[model samples]
Target: MSDTYAGAPAKPGTVSARISPVGGLDVLSRNEVARLRGASGSGLHALLRRCALAVLTSGNISDDPRAILEQYPDFDIQVLQQDRGMKIELSNAPAQAFVDGQIIRGINELLVAVVRDIVYVSTQLEQVGFDLDASAALTQSVFEILRNARILKPQVDPNLVVCWGGHSISRQEYDYTKLVGYQLGLRGLDICTGCGPGAMKGPMKGATISHAKQRRRHNRYIGITEPGIIAAESPNPIVNHLVIMPDIEKRLEAFVRLGHGIIVFPGGVGTAEEILYLLGILLHPDNAGTPFPLIFTGPRQSAAYFEQIDRFLRLSLGDEVARHYQIIVDDPETVARTMIKGLEKVRHNRLDTKDAFFFNWALQIPLEFQLPFRPTHEAMRALQIHHERPRHELAADLRRAFSGIVAGNVKEEGVQAIEQHGPFVIDGDADIMRALDKLLQAFVEQHRMKLPGGTAYEPCYRVLNA
Candidate 1:
């Protein structure tokens, strides 16, 4: 997409404004406001600045997080509490977030979401003393974050479809995502995604139109992201609800817990990481009968992409892994139908197990998958990707491997790490190593590893032979 904002040039510069909150983030305690105003040394200011810049530049596509920061170095935001309610003041903000000196309504709401999540995490979650070490406690943290965002609805049935894919995707593949999303929306399903551009934005864009056609009021376009990623992949403009989790692990857990099903589009290592994360959980023997629908899809021209993904899964995790998902090429209607059918099974399964329809409480996600994986060079090299380990364990390590690649690709800290220490070395089982090398090579060749129009991607990792 073009870096330029759509419509009239957006006044060509920054503007200062104080605006009242809309919707969920209208009220906050005095302590919360003070916490949000903490300086850079205290950690809240820097976090707030980066996330706020991302929101102001929504829809402008550039994978490099620092690029946006450099462009608008003077931009800043502050939460101002007044007698009326919560008010936000922006200084030297991006003009794109405003039209004719007034902030766009959608962007304002998302900006509020950024503040709400940051303050909630800093104050509520940390102060509550929730035991983060235990798996159940960690799961509860995810629930609490979602609940604080008003994401969990008690009366709603199983209808949320969590779409996972790369923020950088081909136009054809992006259109395919929209078609699938349109089909799902027509069927009354809601959309949730990583809240970025490209494939993440495509589905929500399509679903909005379908929802309008069906006269579906209060249709949801939920976007979930984390601090490490929000700068690079800002919440797309279509998102009606936004939530920021503490880390990628919690973010992934939130998606699985809140959604009824998952649909994956052609993407790079980030998408692969998500697929493995879900598969790892589903492969656990305890989750055998869980009816979570997963589909890998793209345009007909992208058939080879899904084929490569399928072969990799089979070769690494065995053919039994194939039972957990379907590869649907170029058939949006069938993908939607399949998801609809699978959701029926999911609804029945929830009823049978006496689990809540909104959250997948019964899904036994091992603590290993729930824990955060910091992809340092040493940590990346230490992963045991051999076949001797259980399939789920191997999948978790493989997911980490991909997660490292994703980090190096877009996240600011990961990029700095790579620049300082050179590429991360990943050595594992011979066969798995070879498969990984081939897969990454394919991603580079297909321009899936980075945004197509940006700088050429340098290898962030080296897969060593066993």
Candidate 2:
């Protein structure tokens, strides 16, 4: 509830403050406090520091994961247990996170979220020995994490729309996303996204105005992110509810299970990864009857972008995969109307199946999709991206390929590996590799690989015919 400025000489653009816990998290056990205080290489302190810095610098636009760390190297955070509750002590934190002399309220809640997730995952989940290796167990673990975050709303109907897009996009495309979001909000739908800048922030920005116009209250702008990509794409200021999953796999699962429908905008490898992940699961025979609304849309100027995505997808996953989603161009009203109709189908289907409205318990996600993929050089080369396999299986491996490229482009570990071992080599069927190479080239030429102000992007993975 209170914070003090550590009135001492500090790095420019950085300040020191000890702030009280916000609403998200307020108390921790003695052991939890000790573990958070631990600064060893294996302890939670380093992870806490990185995630905390990301939260403190919300709305930062940087594709380089290391940029924030390098900017404020001395920044640190600790969880201090006290008589009444717990307090968060921040050292050399970003000055922008504070206004006048107090920490920004929203940023404080997000910081508390960072602490809450790190502690829960380290102490509650891992220590309890959840068999994360098993598929069912893994899904259960994801549910537990969301439940612990209090993100699962049982009374609410199926209204959350997951918006997937890139942080680096043109002003035209960004404006288009906001337009779609505005239309969606006017229809009484909620917005969820990866929680970064650019397209992720656009829809939420648009929705706020429409919501206010309609006199709506308690609107949810949920942002779901993982540890590896948080620093690269910090949560935008519009994200009122932020949940950090343990890894990318869990993060993807949380999106599909929580949202009633999805809207994908123009993006690069990361967005492509999301598209393929959903397509792969939907293609599963067990989920063939499930009604999940998916739409791909953008401004008219970006038509070619979606065309390229469509071509690549049809080539890789076959023409039938196109049935799962529709592409709407330059029409936000139609996009919103289509999504509303789709949600009704989702609603009826859920009712008939006797499933929970908040979570999609009936969707069948296989073990392959649940497992976390560490995109190393050897693993990248081992992907089977040929058309000889089942459509869903092929989509799974293709998703992994895009995921690896995303890692090498932004994630710290993946970047380090690429620097030390060189760009990853992806070997697959000749035609598939050719299509992938062309798609990736388009992303680079369009500057979709990174934020606009950064240096030109270098390919982090090379595709070759096997």
Q: What is the TM-score of each candidate against the true structure?
A: 0.96, 0.98
Q: Assess candidate 1 and give its lDDT.
A: 0.89
C-alpha RMSD of each candidate structure in angstroms: 3.8, 1.3
- Can you write out model 2's per-residue Cα lDDT over 158-185, one digit (the tens) per residue? 8999999999899999999999999999
lDDT of each: 0.89, 0.91
Task: Please give, for residues 1-466, the per-residue lDDT of candidate 1 as tens digits.
Answer: 0122222322247767776667677478877777778843457878999998998898878889799889987777788788977788777788778786678889988888999899888888899998888999999999989988998988788999999998878889999999999999999999999999888998998898899999999999999999999988988889989999999999999999999999999999999999999999999999988899999999998999889999999999999999999999999999999999999999999999999987888999899999999999999999999999999999999999999998998999899999999998998989889989999999999998888785678999999993
Which candidate has the highest lDDT of all?
2
